[model samples]
Target: MNDQQLLRYSRHILLDPIGIEGQDRLLGSRALIVGAGGLGCPSALYLAAAGVGTLVIVDDDEVDMTNLQRQILHREQSVGRAKVDSARDALHDINPGTEVIALKQRLAGDALLEQVAAADVVLDCSDNFATRHAINRACVATRTPLVSGAAIRFDGQVAVFDSREPNAPCYHCLFPEGGESEEVRCAVMGVFAPLTGIIGTVQAAEALKILAQTGRTLAGRLLLLDALGMEWRSIALPRDPGCAVCGEGA
Candidate 1:
């Protein structure tokens, strides 16, 4: 680390757990974030600020007025712009040293698998279930650690799935792909802005812990938060022996 790099990340180095070694790991890690919306916004911001060496943000949507309420990575001036472009600009502004790769196209199938195979950690910040399932499948196949987060209306949830761990559960283990889940959107449901921030920040924290190999990642545990009720709950998630997506059944 150069003199300027040391000064920039002095706070992280000050920690007993995260000394120079941990900070260096963070500076040499690659993180692939799917989605540039609410959860992805803060997740990308903190990861960039923490000096993740390479960041790849993927999202096919364009920013809208509604996103400003919760997506901190985008500003009013960025409305109507591609989400990946806005995210790239914001993250670069936060830390120019971090290589920000913005993929404006929606990734799936073979393309998604290739991306996951290259990343040290993958973050599922998408809104829809199909994309989430696809991302989970890719992560499982590559044995990559995944940090998943979701927030809509007054509810938020975050979890870490470490495919490298034999007993760790993937996102599909908790919520099966074909299972029915009501599609809820902030567009109609009215989300609490900071709720996304809380979950997104946790996503970043979990990713950093996994990359730095310092703290306990949220593997095999799911965190749920109800911002309106001001309640937080964590549930133990077990790897399903018969999970179709990532279980013993091939």
Candidate 2:
């Protein structure tokens, strides 16, 4: 690290756990964020501010006026602009040293696998089930750590799926792809704005922990939050042997 970098990340360096070594690891890591909306906004913000070496953000949607309520990375002027573009600009303004590769498109198939393979960690901040499952599959295939989060209607959840751990549960183990789970959109269900921030922040923390190799991540646990009731719950997650994505058959 240069003299300027040491001064810039002195706060992280001061920590006992995340001292200079951990901070250096963070400065050499790359993260792939799979969304640019509610959850993705705060996650990317912190990751960039914390001095992650590189960040690749993907999103096909454009920023809308409604997003201003919770998507902290975008402003009113960002409306009608591609979400990845808006996010890139904001992240650059926060930390110009962090490299931001903004891809204004949905990530899928081989492209998704390539990104997941290259990243030190993947943040699944996407809103839909299909995208979540796809991200999980790619992470599992690449053996990359994944920080997943979701928020809707005062409810939010976060989980870490680290395929590097033999017993760690992948996302598919918790929510099967073709199960009875229903897709709930914030546009339809009316999400609590701060709930997304809370969940997204947790996702960022887990990702940073994985990158810095400092603290124990939420690898075998699922965290659930009821923002309306101000309650939090932690559930032990077990890997499913029958999971299609990460099972023996897979």
Candidate 3:
């Protein structure tokens, strides 16, 4: 690290857990974030600011005025623009040194697998079940650590899934593919704006810990938050031996 880099991340260097070595690891890491909405916004913000070597943001949606309520990466003028474009620009303004790849399309099949395989970590910030399951499958395939976060209405949840671990529960294990989950959209059911930030920030922390090899990650636990009640709870997660994606028979 140059003199400027030392100064830029001097605070991180002071931490015992993420000292110079850990900060250096963060600087050499690549992360793929699978959304540019509320959750993705804060995750991207902190990862970029922390000097992650490379950040890949994927999204096919355009910025909407309604999204501004929580998606801090987009501004009023960014409306109508592709979300990835706006997010890339915003991340650049924060840390031009960090390479940001903006893919303005929904990643699926080989495309998604390729990105997931290339990344050191994957953050599932998308707000849909299909995308979450797909991301989990790709992460499990690559043995990459995934930091997942979601927020709808006044509730939010976060979890870390590391296929590298023998019995870490994946997103599908907790919410099965064929399961009956009432899909709730922030558009239909109003979401508390800060709720997204809280969950996204936790995702960022988990991702950084994974990259820096700091404390133990939430590999076998799920963090849930009720913004309305202002309470937080954690649930232990167990891997499903019969999980189709990560099962031995698969």
Q: How does each model score on TM-score?
A: 0.98, 0.99, 0.98
- Local accuracy of candidate 1 as per-residue lDDT tens digits, 59-150: 99999998998899999999999999999998889999999999999898999999999999999999888898899999999999999999
- Residue 184's C-alpha lDDT in candidate 1? 82
The TM-score obtained by model 3 is 0.98
Cα deviation of 148, candidate 3, in Å: 0.7
Per-residue lDDT of model 2, residues 1-250, tens digit only: 9999999999999999999999999889999999999999999999999999999999999999999999999999989999999999999999999999999888899999999999999999998999999999999999999999999999999999999998789999999999999899999999999999999999999999999997889999999999999999999999999899998787
Encode model 3's per-residue lDDT on 125-196: one tens digit a residue. 998899999999999999999999999999999999999988887888888898998788898998999999
> Per-prediction count of colliding residue pairs?
0, 0, 0
Q: lDDT per prediction?
A: 0.93, 0.95, 0.94
Question: Between candidates 1 and 2, which one is better according to TM-score?
Answer: 2
**Native-to-model Cα distance after best TM-score fit, residue 111 in candidate 2, in Å:** 0.7
Tell me the lDDT of candidate 3: 0.94
Ordering by TM-score: 2, 3, 1
